[model samples]
Target: MEATHRVLVVDDDADIRDLLVFVLEQAGLEVSWAETGEDALAKVREHQPDLVTLDLTLPDMDGTEVCRRLREFSDAYVVMITGRASETDRLVGLEVGADDYMNKPFSPREVLARVSALLRRPRLGAPSEPASSVEEPAPVAGPADAELDVGGGLVLDSARHVATLDGERVMLTPAEFDLLRALATRPGEAWEREELVREVWQGEFIESDFLVDVHIANLRRKLRRAGSRTTWIRTVGGASYLYDPS
Candidate 1:
């Protein structure tokens, strides 16, 4: 039998949590729900879900922190749901490594669609093979000479989705690593916000462009925490961003 797609739904609101569990289960996915970030993390480690629907506001910890923490272990897909409509919130969520975002009072259908799109995305950071699967494995970093060398001190195992900076392993969520690789792989190319959204988030379409900024901010924070330099992702005009390999 084919493996079931497991989804972890995290929200402080009981109604929203239950509603998502019902809707996602009805859609044929194996669903689990958590009322807090701590609970969500425990369940995530236990179940190892295929995808996650996370509310930006959680009781124990903000959704952004949750996103950062999860990246340390699992490579599951994350879609952040926020009650605030502020650009800062959207940007922050993305920066913390969310794969996608949805503002509150959102349609269950839209939420379902985003979840489906993310789930359908090519299985990232895996070796390439036949093209029959719904999502292609993330492109590998092989023996190419022309590839951006972020630094000889750092090695990114793209296929396995791991990064080692200065011989010490650092943790990143799948989304975080993808963002880093997208920027680092090119090294000096100026990647506009729209370009990052399209390239880093290839499967699903982001409705608001500001979402890119939030993710970039989050990526910078995490990389900084890992003691890696993020000067490579240069911001331009408060509108666009680029990667400087130099």
Candidate 2:
């Protein structure tokens, strides 16, 4: 028998909390709610949920900060649901470790849909225990073709949910790891943004082109920070991204 999937809903508004809880519970998920950032963090630490729905505005702290702090200890997928709809806001949200972003006045059905998409696709490379979060920075290299064992000593261990650079662990989000695996598996293959969306995200959630760009950019930043000496992943055109081992 499979274990029940758990979700935490964090919003300052009681109505929104109730709505999300009701919707998720109706969908056969075990749901929890928190009304403040600190409480949300506490609940996450305690529950070790599979996902979190977070509002950008919290009474105790900004939602982005909450996410950044959460990333320190938990890799639970986060969806930033807020009234802020600016490009800057969305980018910042994603940059801080949010897996997805949604504007306010959203349909409950759409919220359910995105949540369902995320829940359906747990970390493909998660470990036996939990892919809860990335370990301390051991950044190394990217993957290569065929078994992701190429790219100048970059190796990916899918069964273990780890990618190593010169044998150093390169911490990656589940999506980031999947993206690297896709590129590394087919070195020199230029994938259009739309195609990538389908490839990585399984084409289940409705998303704009920027979603791919943001994730790719995040992947790049992490690799660079991990002391990568080469730009392994590159853009071929306005709409295509590829991994080039050479």
Candidate 3:
């Protein structure tokens, strides 16, 4: 039998918490809940859940801070829940390392669907091998025509879900890595926003195009921090984004 995926639901609203717990439990996941950001962090540390449904406004601290802190040690997927529907709010959540965002008054079914979709996707980190194994396994090529060398000392190993710049590993969120991999696959191809959403998000419905932009921005930031001097991912102005390594 497959191991049960764990979820940490963080929300101060009693009704919302109960609703999420019910829906998630119905989905066959091991669900836990916290009423504050501090408690949420504690639960995360203790349980090391596979995913977290975090409310942006928490009594103890802002959810973005919680997300930032969580990213320091955990790569578990985070879906931010916010009462505010502003683009700025969503972008802030994404910048803080949230894998997805949902506005207030969201359907319980939609929330469950998002959770299910996220859990179904593979994470970026590689599994550890036995200490006695001296030889490294050969890198496997992805469907995008082998690993992409995006110049500027950047290499994307899709098979191992690893990205390296200047011979150093570049830590990326699962969403960022997927977006980069999708663009790098067909360099210079201006992929439409919808197409990218379908490809990277696996057909999950995103309410706004800003979701893509936010993830793209995060990807660029991480890549630049990883020591790449040139701009690789570029916007096409009213069209799409392309991986232009020129």
- Identify the superior model by lDDT, candidate 2 or candidate 3: 3
lDDT of 2 at 185: 71
Residue-wise lDDT of candidate 1 within 172-245, one digit each (tens)?
66666667777776776677776675666644446636666666666666667778664657887777777653
lDDT values for all models:
0.70, 0.76, 0.78
Model 1 vs. true fold: TM: 0.72
Query: What CA root-mean-square deviation does each model show from the true structure?
Result: 4.7, 6.4, 6.9
Clash tally, candidates in order: 11, 3, 0
TM-score, per-candidate, Cα-based: 0.72, 0.85, 0.86
Candidate 2 per-residue lDDT, tens place, 189-232, comes to 89887766665554344475888889889888887787887788
| Worst-scoring 10-residue span by lDDT in model 1 | 125-134
Off by over 4 Å in 1: 1-3, 12-15, 57-73, 87-97, 121-152, 203-208, 224-230, 236-238
Per-residue lDDT of candidate 3, residues 105-197 (tens digit): 989667766776666555544332221112222222244324668777788876556788878998887778778877887888898888877
Task: State residue 113's C-alpha deviation in candidate 3, in Å.
Answer: 2.1
Candidate 2 regions off by >4 Å? 1-3, 124-147, 203-205
Predict model 3's lDDT versus the native.
Answer: 0.78
Give model 1's clash tally: 11
Which of the two candidates, 1 or 3, achieves a greater lDDT against the reference? 3
